[model samples]
Target chain A: MNSTLLRTSALRSALRAAAPKTSSRAGLAGTTFVRSKVTLPDLPYDYGALEPAISGKIMELHHSKHHNTYVTSFNNFSEQMAEAKHKEDIQTQIALQPLINFHGGGHINHSLFWENLAPTSKGGGEPPKGQLAKAINDNYGSLDAFKEKFNAALAGIQGSGWAWLVQDTQTGGIQIKTYANQDPVVGQFRPILGIDAWEHAYYLQYENRKAEYFKAIWDVINWQAAEKRFK
Target chain B: MSAPTYTLPPLPYAYDALEPHISAQIMELHHNKHHQTYITNLNSALRSQAEAVHASDITTQVSLQQAIKFNAGGHINHSLFWQNLAPASSVDAKSSSAPELIKQIKATWGDEESFREAFKAALLGIQGSGWGWLVKVETGKEQRLAIVTTKDQDPIVGKGETPIFGVDMWEHAYYLQYLNGKASYVENIWNVINWKTAEERFKGTRADAFRIFKASI
Candidate 1:
């Protein structure tokens, strides 16, 4: 985990160093610069791997169509922002903020969500172990109790949103949080697990009986991935 | 001044009235739970906005813009939506009941079928949670009809424009029965549209069209 964190920060610093320091009309006239673009991450499992819990059709649409749209839109808006910034167009930049947040957060959330699932054959639904298990037991008495609380939060979400199990970076305690729309878990909270409550997540199979989807998702939850995040 | 509270308005027809087109379960949850939650949240946001106003807190007031817009728009849109629908068996469900509105629709799109096709296309074009509206736009003495869509609980509030009728394109509107078959939901909605209400809204003033919303406060 320490190595991974170190690598991420190192890459970020490298990118920052490569970025242009100043925007000038002469500098922009004919210069070519590298701009990083976010791309849709490949799912860890096949579309059909989750099986009876979630349909392959739904997974295909969710990943290819929905998640890809976010990635594409985020990149598009980022390009627009760069152009706006160069022109000193404050109003245009301000107007693009919400679109950037929505699509960028959607990309971040879905990327994490894909990593947090695995086929049942590949340790999906396996219970948490070691430190993660102890934390769950300490926080909510039992894993069953924790899941019940998580499911309740998932069910209570209005319209399109996600429910997350997050760890406080400061206190190192876990809590369930709900975000409206594509709002991501940020600030002091580190997202350990997230379940999308958007209709597109389960409407193909569960329809309006979202409680069924919420309950059934447990069968395919990649707890090992969650446990890693918990650490 | 105190913030005005809003309440959920009852559906104009029974839950099962839409029948095989839309399920009773969908209607019950959509109306009782989904619509009710919006009103509850709207009232809460209004109260918060009122406190912010009293305290002269511009920052808090700005922060509450989204909550107020989402919840209030939800309340207003759903209020109009309930009145916009009728049981398929009712006389109001027939387009002929709205002769003037039908005439306008025909005039706008060459024929009623063409108009419906355009509306259906607009409904399906929406990528996420939203509403599809057929609105009346009046520019001086010239009145025109147009189809428009609003994203995420935004209401039709343009000056000189009034919603003739709107179809809820949100997933909750048909996902229970239609699931991902959004095209079918859009196709079937025309069957339950209350043309009687459409005619009244077409002929009446904006205040008259929004009277149901006023009654909810």
Candidate 2:
């Protein structure tokens, strides 16, 4: 084959090869988090794009309304906190319970929640490549097994919480964990994959049936984006 | 940036999505009630503690220390757990060759799997109400993964190393189905492992590990 043709073939092959791994990544490398004044992020895609799996109504209420409330409250809480600090009023500060965690956690988790999704047509089905694949295979014997285990683990959550696939930094292997609420994996491990088990994440579309929502969200998972998340 | 604030996070999936494995009934209670409780408690503690810290009031700070640790740790760990499990994708494909991060782990413990296995054992072995962590100690940018355990709600950040991964061993974390079967819970949690995020963390913290691994290599 001519060099140009050969190059074209190679390029096609590379693209085909890479198509799979680019789905799940949030592109945090390019996602510059400068910690500017904290504000609610506008949803990147229309709230309804995840339809059937997630309703537009839910997205609207969850994002424009719920998440925004958190952002606003977090800012207000912080401002008051600063004042509390100035006055050295320990009792008043103690009274501010719940506001900081609820709003603060709302802001953080929703930011991640928005980035975790993409439209179904955008390479959301099935994971493409890497140790994530091999690890899944090794641990569960197959991708299907991995998903089953994950879904099962997620289903097993009790009360308001989350299910996660986190890397054990000391051993550098992936491990699954669940947190009661707005807990970040930072202190114990580096977060890699997190599934929100909150009712609000699914109540509208799935009603009180979380499993249906879990099954449906797979349609728009953005696995290729996840691949890029690898270092 | 502005100290810190707390809030409830919306779910990434709809309520019924995880059915069979998880009931929508459970999810409703879990998010609105359980998770919300933590956020509320954390905020209260932070507010009170901020006041004490500003006042330089030893008695108040000391008394609230427990509250701060538990609530703050809960906030920190849960948020990280959310980001860790994105939808499954090949973009997080396993490296065919030794990823630089794996090389460092190998150098430290003879092989990557060995290090991983040891870390797993440490996490799975936790006796009760606490956490297992892998952290990188900073020695002028050189870092190494060290397994540490925290009791109740103490966070690992204050322990002098950059956190890499944290495993929760609380029964509330897995008791619905695993029910006292912590081993099964730990083992099962590995299936949807997110190597991609781990890779980002590895590369981002390379300087910390390089300083330590170079000598051993």
Best candidate (score: lDDT): 1
User: In model 1, where do residues sit more than 4 Å from their true spots?
Assistant: A1-115, A119-195, A202-231
Residue A56's C-alpha lDDT in candidate 2?
91
- Evaluate residue A148 in candidate 2 and report its C-alpha lDDT on the 0 to 100 scale: 78
| CA lDDT scores, all candidates in order | 0.83, 0.60
Over A163-227, each residue of candidate 2 has an lDDT whose tens digit, in order, gives 76777777767767887655545554655666777656676456445788777777766555445
Instruction: Give the TM-score (vs. native) of candidate 1.
Output: 0.65
Measured with C-alpha atoms, the lDDT of residue A205 in candidate 2 is: 58
What part of the reference interface contacts, as a 0 to 1 fraction, does candidate 2 reproduce? 0.00
Candidate 1, residue A26: how far the Cα is off, in Å: 32
| Tens digits of per-residue lDDT for model 2, B80-171 | 44333333333442432227656777778898678768877887644335677666666775677677877555665653466555666654
A144-180: candidate 1 lDDT, tens digit per residue: 9999999999976656789999999999999999987
